[model samples]
Every structure is written in C-alpha cells, then in structure tokens.
Target: MFQKIFRSYINSFSDLRREVWLLAFITFINRAGTMVIPFLSLYLTKSRGFSLEEVGWILTFFGLGSVAGSWVGGKLVDSIGHYKTMTASLLLSAVLFVLLQFPVSFWSICAGIFLVMLVADAFRPAVFVAISAYSKPENRTRSVTLIRLAINLGFSAGPAVGGLIIANSGYSGLFWVDGITCFLAGLLLLKLLHPKKAKENVKEVNLNPQAVLNDKPYLLFIGAMILFGFIFIQYFSTMPLYYSEVHLLPESDIGLLLGINGFLIFLLEMPLIKYMETKNSSALQNVILGTFLVAISFLVLNLTGWIGALLVGMLFMTIGEMIAFPFSNTFALKRAERGKQGSYMALYSIAFSISHIFGHNSGMQLIGEFGFNLTWYIMVFLGVVACALILWLIRILKKEAVSYSSTPIL
Candidate 1:
C-alpha cells in the first residue's frame, strides 16, 4: 500500500522537463528566505510605532509597485528576454532589501517598500512566462503545481525560521537573510538557468501586449482573477493583523498558524490537483469552488475565536488555493498565443497586484471601522460575487471552446 502511494506521488510530477525542475529549485531557494514581509505589518505597528492606517498606506504602495513591476518585467522579458529580467530583478531586489533595513521614517519606509516590492516581484511574470515556454501543454498545470510545491515548502520553512530570527536578532535579521538568499538565487539562475530554455515557440504567437488586451474573454477572466486575488491576499495581510490584534497571539504562534497553511499545501495540493485534473474538472469550476472554500474559511472564523477554529479555517483556505491557482494560471495561459506569453502572464500578475493593494489597504480600514466579524462577512459576500464572475467568464470563453475542445485540458 505504501509503495502504491509512493508511485502515485511520483506520477504527479511526470511529463515535466529538466528546465521546469530547475526553475522549481530556484523558486524554492528564493522563497525559503522570504520572511521579512510576512512580519512587516507587526513590525510597522508594534515596533516602528505606526498606526494600522499608516501600515495600510505603506503596503498599498508596495502593491502599486508590484503592478508596475509586473508590467515592466513582462515587457522586458518579451523585449530583452527572461534571463536578463530574472537576473536583474533578483540582484536589484537584493540591494533594495538591504536598503530597506536601514532605520527610516514613514515616508522613507514606504519608498523602500515600494522599490523592494517592485524589484522583487518583477521576476514573477518572467517565471510564469518561462514555465509556459518550457513545459508541454499537457503538462502545463503540473509544472505550475510543482513549482508552487517548491514555494510552499519554502514557505513552510521561512515563517517558522522567521519567528526564531525575529525573536533573536530582530527585524533587521529578517531583511539580511532575505537579501542574501535573493542574491544567491540570482547568481544561481545566471549560472545554471539558461535563456535558451525560454526561447521555445516564441515566434509562433503575436508579440504585442495589445493583442492580449484585445481578447474580450481573456480580459473578463483577468478581471475575475483580481477578485479572486483580493480574497486570497487576505491570508497574507489582514488575517495576520486580525489574529495579532484580537487573539493577542505572539509572533511565534502566528507564524506557526501560517506555517500550517504552507505545510498543508505541500502535503495535499499535488495529489488533489492531480485527481481534479484526471477527473477533467474545468478550471472555471475549480476556481469557483476554490473561491467559495476561501469564503467559507473566513466565515467559519466568525463562529468561534478558538485557535483550533482558525487552523481549521486555514486548512480550508489552503485547499481552496491548491485547487484554484495552478489551474487558473494554466487556464489563462491557454489563451495566449505563443509570442504573447510574457505579456499575457504580465497582465495576469497585475490582478494579484491589485489585490494586494485593495485587499490589504481596505481590509485594514474595514477592521478598524466596523470590526473583524463584519469584515469577514463582507469577504464572504465578495467571494460569492467572484464565483459568479468566474462563471460568466466561462460562458464568454465557451464561444471559443470549440477550437480547444480537441485538446486534453487541465
């Protein structure tokens, strides 16, 4: 029985190339030291003596920068190529991370965060483009899922280690570790990852970013993604603040709870996603279900304040995330003709950026004004709307589905 399960596990990773695996390793390394930002809210409020409103504005700037970065990176990847964009973003972000560690005022911190988020996240679109370029269509979602597996495994380690680091060496230590790891990842990519890997089939599709914008169905889908992103981001932003403020949980305890999310994703996501893919569930269906699960995850929190309840809610959210994101990414990328992958993926990254901006900033205000329960209630309502929007996108895409009906899908 154990052998059968092990074979099943290995089968989930089949059909991917070496380049895909290499990218996953790079992602794992990059994410492993991503500890500073998760704790940034508490650091700003408790240690830096900023108000929740102030932190909201600060994080909003980060989101704005990420949006800009995604656009720039996507363009650069298409123009100069992914290799240069990937290397530059990582190296530049390393410097930015170090600069952000300096003692600074509110405005200075905001500026630092903006630049850091911009440079740091610029690599995202490039990574997405690379994955699409390197993998076969049949293996696309699996490639994304495997890379996400690396990220989640790293996340599982980063926060737990971050709690200890913050406890011992303070917030500055978090920045130092993050900076060093990012720099190392850049160097490794330059050394091991090849630009040629991302060059496959690029000449086949239109290179214009405008071409992506012209697709009505794709645009609607991107819009829905922003809604999904808004809900998903609360896990990283408002959820922490709410837990710390209401439960009075220590950073270590909060870290543990967050770690559970990554741990669960690492353990269960691949097999679950494989099953869903095998069962031939539509990506839209998966995304809608995932969105609803996330809504339920938050709604359940309203029932009780116990730590156990929060953990259970987190488990639900992680499962939702596992189902929704990889398939959603694959779904969107399917719309891109070959040369437009970078541009398409770049636009896709913007949805999440908007989420970070709107979700974090607005969630802070809502919690401050009305309180946590009401804020969660509103989130549940939005999730319902998001589910509907996704379904609408499905109807729009169905017009074009006839051409794609012959292909095996995620």
Candidate 2:
C-alpha cells in the first residue's frame, strides 16, 4: 500500500526518475546522521560538563567551517563532479564522527568539529545542485520539495530516536548511531550515483564562484535567505532551551514537539507545493508570507500555560516554512546562470550555515541571562527585519520582470 502511494505521487510529477528517488533515499540517511548534532549543545553543556560559553564557541566554529565548506564545495562540484564530491565528503565525515567519539581536550574537540563541518557541509550543496541538474525544468520545484521532504523525514525520525537514546544511553549513543548512518549513506552514494565529471572547458565555462555573488538579483535573494535563516535557526537553540529551562517542560514533551514539527513537514510539504501550483502564487509572495508566519510563531511562547496555543503557533510556523523553502530554491535556480546553478546554490546554502551558527551562539547567551521570553522577542524582531528584506526583493524582482518582458523573445 505504501509503495503504491509512493509510485502514484512520483508519477504525478514530471521528470522524476528512479535515480532521483534513489538519491532522495541516500539524502535521507545522510540527514538523519546530521540530525544528531542539534542536541549537541545541550549534551555538551548540560550533560558533558563543558561550559555553556565554550559550547557556544564550538558551535560557532562549526558554522564558520561550514561557510568555508560552501565555497570549496561549489568549486569541487565543478571540478570533480557532484557524485565524487559527495562520496568523498561522506566518507571523510564518517571518519571525523569516529574521531569525535574519543575523549579529547576542548580544543581538540573544537578542531575536530570544525573539520567535520567542513567536509560534511560539502555534500549538501552538491546534492541540491545535482537535484537541480537532473530534474526537468518544469518539475524543478517539485524536485527541490522532494529533497526537503527527505530531509524533514530524516530529521523527524532522527531526533525522536536521538532523544530516546540520550535519555537512556547518553551522548555516546548519539555519536555511534550517527556515525554508522553517515557511513551507510556514503555506501549508498557509491553504489547508486555515477555522474560523469564535467569536461574541462564546460566546467570552466559554467562554474564561477564570483558569479553568484555578483548577480544583483541573486545577491538580493541571498541576503533574504541569510536573514530568514538567522530567524529560523533559533528553533534549534533558543526554542529547545525555552522548553527545557524557562517553561520547565518535560524533556519528553520537547521531543514530542520536535516530532510533531518534523511529521508536519513530512506529510505536508510535497502536497503544499502541488497545491501552490494550482493557486498560481508567485514564489516571492510565498516567501514573504512564510517569513511573516515564522515571525508570528514566536509569539506563542509568551503564553506559558497554554500548550495548545504553542501547538497552534507551531502549525502556522510550519505552514510558512512549507511555502517558503521550495520556492526559495526555485527562485535561486531561476536566477542562476546556465551551468552555474551549483555555484549559486552553494552560496545560498552558506547563508544557512552562517546564520545558524550566529543564531545559536547568540541565542545561548540571551537564553542564559535574559530568559526565553526575551529571546523569542528578539527572534521576532529579526524575523521582521528579514521580512523587510524580502519586500525589497519583491520590488527588485518586479523591475526585473518588466525589463525581461520588454526584451525580444528567443
């Protein structure tokens, strides 16, 4: 029954092949491993005896490393091809995971985390770029949605399992399980993905690291994504801490909230994209609405006693996310130069890694002293700022649309 439903959904979309579906499966395994780290700040500071400030710094290092990875990963995709770059990244990341399991000095752990992030971050852009490359132009948004759906599904399951493991077996279990999953993901990539390397001249013609940054419209989109990412990243850091410390909620319930969050994505994302096609909304409009919803979701945390209120807020927040993400990718791809999609996508991803580190580290400090309520207030403010940027992007896009329409058709 499940297989039949899956086939039906795949058939509903154009240009989705067996290979893309297989790649999605591999991405799921890769992300499931990545999910283990979201709880690491809590583990390191609360359970493992690292100072809160130190944990924040370590997280920052990981983020900084990811920024570097995004740039290098883009070049690697052009040079070695997506399949090889992904395979190398996965294998190296698995090795780093094992290295992390050993008892090491704080500086050593920091260094290790940095290296791990550098390699692991490498796989993500290549994966997304490959999705864009393989997908038919008309079905591009749906392809991106499938990638996100895979990520959401992995994240949903991984955290519930991580929470249980942390509760029972501790941090060691999280590391071991995640490490194994990383290796498994690599093996899957090895067997399934065999993309040929770009020819030297074609690679040279298409991939330009500077092209992504220089394109005025694309840069505007990147700025919006960065701001949006900063606001969204608070969930991993500030939101969880709010539940655990400020609200004095049971840890299990926090896990349940995360589970609900993930489940909603798994169920709603692809369907939402399909429905949006019928509604005929512009991608920019969807992005604007989604950011607004995410901002408002933080307001619910102020209601201390009303769990139902919090749930309502989360539902709306998820709605915003479902609308925003797939369209964001589509917009970026649309603006990207022919053959330079990987470079643009990699640069776009850098925004997330950069914002996440900033949000998480800064959020830790805010939550520690000012309390969770104030943190949410701050996050709401950032969300507003992000919305303003998106509005500006809309204006820029309008001018571009008019200009393009005035041009001679091919």
Candidate 3:
C-alpha cells in the first residue's frame, strides 16, 4: 500500500515538459538560498537592537521596493522577454544582498532592505511569464504547483541550515550564502535557457490582449488576493517573533518549526493539487476554502498556549497556502491576454507587495501595542473580508460568462 501510494504521488509530477522541470529546479536553487528573510526580524531585534516599531518601518520599506520591482519587472518582461529580465534581476539582487550585510543604522538598514527586495522581487513577475511560456494550458496550475513544490523544498532546507549558520557564523553568513545562490541560479538559467531559443519555441494563443486596467473583475480578484496576502504574510513577519517571545523557543527550534511548514507543503501539495484538478473545482472556491483555513489557523493559537497548538496552527496554515497560491497564480495567468501577460502578472505580484506593505508593519505594531491575541483576531476578520471579495469576483465572472474553473476562460 505504501509503495502504491508513493508511486501515485510520483505520477502526479509526471507529464510536465522538460522546461517546466528545469524552471522548478532553478526556482529551488534560488529559494534554497533564501535564508535571510526568515531570520531578518530576529536579526534586527536581537543583534541590531531595533525596536519592534523600527522593524515594522523597515519591512514597510521592503514592501515599497517590492511594489516598484513588480511593476518594473512586468514591463521589462513585456518589452525584453522573461529570460533577460529574470537573468538581470537575479544577478543584481545578488549584489544587493551582499551589500545589505554592511548596513547597521536604522535608516541605512531600511534603505538596504528596500533596495534588496526591489531587485529580488522583480524575479516574481518574470518567472510567472516564463512559466506561462513553458507549460501547456491544461497543466498550467500543476506546473505552478511543481514550482511551488521546489520553493517549499528549498525553504524546508533553508531555515534549518540558516539556523545552524547563524549559530556558527552569525547573520553575515546568511547574506553570503544568499548572494552566492542568486548568482549561481542566474548563471544556470543563462547557460541552460538561451533567450533566442526560448523566444522561438514560445507558443502564443489568440488571447484578447486587453489592457489590465480595463479588466474590472480581475482587479477585484487582485483586491481579494491583497487581503489574503495580508492575512498569510503574518506568518512570515510576526509569527516568528510570537514563537520567540511567547513560546520562548530558541532560534534553532524556531527554524525547525518554520521548516515544518515547507516540509508539509513539499510532501502534500502536489498530490493535493493533482486531486483538486480532477475534481474540476473553481479557482475561487478553492481560494475561499484556503482563506478560511488560514483564518482558523490563527484562531487555533488562541485556543491554548501549548506548544502543540503551534504545530496544529502550522498544519492549517500550510494546507491553506498549498491550496490558495497555485490557483491564484493560475487565475492571474489565465486572465491575461497573450501580449499583456506581463502586465497581468505584475499586478498580481503587486497585490502581494501591497499586502506586505500593510501586513508586516501593521502586524508588528498590533502585537507591540495590543498583543498577539488581538492581532490574530484581526487577521481572522480580514480573512473573512477576503473571502467575501472573492465571492463578489466570482459572481462578476459568472455574469460575464467567464469560466474560472480548472479550465482556462479562453
């Protein structure tokens, strides 16, 4: 039975094109080196002596930079192609990450964080465009899931390794590793995926090529995503602090706990996504279900102060993330016209960027002022709001005779 189950799981990943697998591998390499983000708030407070409020401000700057990066990256993909845009973003981001290690003062660190994210996040929209170019329409969501699987696999390793590196060599080590990986990922992409060849092979369909601004339903979907992102990003920005301050877990334990989130996604998400695809569930329905689960994950924390609650909460959060993100991505990609894909994806990436702007800073301030319980309640409330917005988006799409199911509207 176990062998059969394992084979079934393996089969879920089969049938994707070779380029899709290569993209997933590249994403894994890049994401594996993402050690700095999971530990950044801790580094600021424990090492640099920044107040919670100060960290909030710094993270807000990071969001602003992400917004800029997503916009520019989307435009660059439209004009220059995803290959060149991705290569430049990764190489430039590597340099910025290394430079960030030297900044110490409050403003300097804020500036440094902003600059680093600006370049790093440009990779988001460009990669989305690349995935669209690489995968068949029928398997697009699974392709996104495969890439997400790689990201989670990398994340599972990164935090545990980051904790060990911090224990031995300090936060400086994280910057160096992150920089090297970015550089290496860029080089690998350049060597394996030539721009001219990639452009020649891209299969274009007869999409509407409409301006993204004209798509009101999509804009509403973006609004819903922003709210969802606001709720979800709290796990990254403030939950680590919650683990440290309230639970009194050490950095190593915290890393392991965070690692569990990625581990769970790595193990379960692909099979789950494959199963969901078979059910022919609408993307908005899955998104609503995922949003509710995320809200409940936070509410679980309020049920008890026990360490087991944290484990339970993480499980819910991970499942919710696995359900929501790939569908959200597939929805955005499907909504775009062929020529306007970059603009559509950029706006999609920007929704999360906007969430980061408000999500991290507001979460930090809420915890600092009102405590963790209140913040969790607020997140739950926001999750409900996001669900309502998605429902509204669904109604609009239905009225327009647009399909938002496993099948693409086109």
Candidate 4:
C-alpha cells in the first residue's frame, strides 16, 4: 500500500524538465508576495475609507487594465521574447506597488490600481508561454499544474501571514512587503531562467501579428471562458468581503479558510490530474465539470450560514479551480501554433480579466439590494450557461481537429 502511494506520487511528479522546475520556483516566489489581492477589499474598506460600490468600480478599472495588459503582453512577449517581458513587467509592478502606497485621493487610488494591474497581470501570458516553451507536449498540463502547486504553496503562506501583518504593521506593510517580493521574484528570474537555452527546446516563435484572431473556434472558447470566469473572479474580488462583512469573520479567520483552499490544491490536485490524464479526460470535460462544481460551491453558501459550510464550499471551489485552470491553459496550448503561444495565452487570460469588469459590481449590487441568496442563485444560473457553452465549444474543437487531420498535403 505504501509503495503504491509512493509510486503514484512519483509518477505524478516525474518527467518535468529542469527549466520547468526553475519557472515553477519563480512562480512560487511571485505568488508568495500575493498579499495585496486577498486583503485588498479590507484594505480599501477599512484603511482607505472606500465604500463597497466605489471599491467595485475601482477594481473594475483594474480589470480593464488587466484586459489591455494581457493582450499587449502577448504581443510584447512574441516581439521581445518572454524572459525580458516577464522581468520588466515584474519590476515595473514593484515600482507601481510603492507608488500605490502614496495615494490619498480616490482617483489616484483608482489610477494606481489600474496601472499596477496593467503591469503585473502582463506577467501571466509570459509565464504561460514559458511553461509551454519549457515542457514536453505530453507533460504540458502537469507542468502547468506544478506551477500552480508552487503558487498555492505560496498562497498558503501569504494571506495567513498577511492577517498578522495587518495586525502588526497596517496596510502600508502589505504594500511594501508585496513590492519587495516582486523585486525579489524579478531578480531571481533574471539570475536563473536562461531564455535562449529554453527556446531551443520549443520551435521558433511565430511572429505573425494576426495569427491568433483568425481562429473562430478559439474565439468561441474564449467567450465561454468569460462566462465562467465571472464567477471565478469572485474568489479574489468579493468572497473575502462576504466572509468579513456578512459572516463577520475576522481577517485571520478568512485567511485560514483561504489557506484551506491552498492546502487542498497542494495536496490533491496533481494526483487527481495524473489520474484524469491517464483516463484521457478531455479539456472540455474538465471545464464543464469544474463549472458544475463551482456552481454547487456558490449554492452551498446559500444553503447554510455555518462556518463549516463555508469551508466545505471552498473545498469544492478549490477542486474546481485546480481542474479548470490547468486544463483551460493546456487547452489553449493545444489549439495554438508555435510562436503564437503567447497570443493564445493572452486571449485565454482575457476571459478572467473581462469578467472582472462586471463581476464585482454585480455581486456587490445584488447582495446590497436583493441579498446573498439571490446573488448566489444568479451565479448558479451563469455557471449552467457556461457549461452549455463549453459543450458547444467541445464540438467546435473536435470538428477542427478532424478537419486539420483530414487535410492532405498536395
């Protein structure tokens, strides 16, 4: 029994390249500093004196910048190469985080958050392209999952400590600590990741400017991503507020719950993914099933007001996230041609960015007016629609795969 468990673990972890491991380290470092996001609502409401509605709009602006940044980052990565783009973006975000600490007025705060996200979120596309560039084709999903493991490990620490940071040093401490970590991550990437060496493994990047937009099937997949993404964004956006304001849980309690989210991903995700990969699970199956789980997680919140229920709900949500996020990324990689990987990833990323534009507003408004029950039900409805769209997207992807295979070279 012990040997089988050990073998399963080894099988799930083996076969990743050295470059993939280094990139995972950078991911872990980058995510370790992720204190600002989980606590941003509390920071805004308690420290900055913003109302819920105002914070919603400002975060929405941040999302708008994120959308533009993801698109631009893809083009930039394709142009300048992934290493330079990622390092530059991370360093720039560090500077912006410091600048954000100086803000007094609302518009300044808004502009600061928007600019910070524009710089920071650009890192997403570069990392995705790098992971694809570094991993073998068969191992891409696990490569991404390994990176997520690092991220969740860091996440497990960031917030739990961040609650204590808030207690000891106040909001300014969060910003400074976050900024310093960003700087450290950027520096580590510069020292460690040799892009020229890794690029040799993957094919030469395609520099065709309009290549990604021409794919109709990929476009529809992005549409479906956006629908489900709106709900996913709540994890970072309004969910913390629900715990803090509605349930009246302390920040420490919220952090512990989110830590549960991280631990679940860390402990279970890779093994389950390995099992699924063995069974030949389709990407669309991951997306659709994950969407159903996300819907159920939200509905669980409404079914009970107990703290245990929140933990159970988060466990469900974390499982869905582990399944959905990795597969969606690998799905984009399969659909993209070489060199266009960055653009495909950027477009895939925009689904979440676009969702942020309205996700917070809708959640906050519905809760403020109608109440949490209605808000959760609406999330359930959207999840069902997102699953339906993914089903349609699966058909489109299958048709394209067949067409590509059937075409004979003359």
CA lDDT of each prediction against the hidden true structure? 0.82, 0.75, 0.87, 0.82
Judged by lDDT, which candidate is best?
3
Against the true structure, candidate 4 reaches a TM-score of: 0.87
lDDT per residue, candidate 4, 98-190, as tens digits? 678798788988888888888988898999889878898778889999998988888777887888988999989988988888999999898
In candidate 3, what residue range of length 10 has the lowest lDDT sum?
Answer: 401-410
Regions of model 2 farther than 4 Å from truth:
1-15, 35-39, 42-49, 160-177, 196-210, 244-248, 300-306, 366-375, 401-410
> In the order shown, what is each candidate's alpha-carbon RMSD?
3.1, 4.4, 3.0, 3.8
Q: In model 3, where do residues sit more than 4 Å from their true spots?
A: 42-53, 103-108, 163-173, 196-208, 240-256, 302-309, 368-371, 403-410
Tell me the deviation in Å of residue 211 in model 4.
Answer: 3.3
**Structure candidate 3, residue pairs in collision:** none
Compute the lDDT of residue 105 as modeled in candidate 1.
Answer: 95
lDDT digits (tens) for residues 85-150 of candidate 1: 889998998888877888569999988888888888889989987887788777788889998899
Pairs clashing within candidate 1: none
- Count residue pairs with overlapping backbones in model 2: 0
Q: What lDDT is obtained when candidate 1 is compared to the true structure?
A: 0.82
For candidate 2, the per-residue lDDT at 42 reads 81
By summed lDDT, which 10 consecutive residues of candidate 2 come out lowest?
Answer: 401-410
Name the 10 consecutive residues with the lowest summed lDDT in model 1. Answer: 401-410
- For model 1, the superposed segments whose C-alpha errors exceed 4 Å read 42-53, 163-173, 198-203, 207-210, 240-256, 301-312, 368-371, 408-410
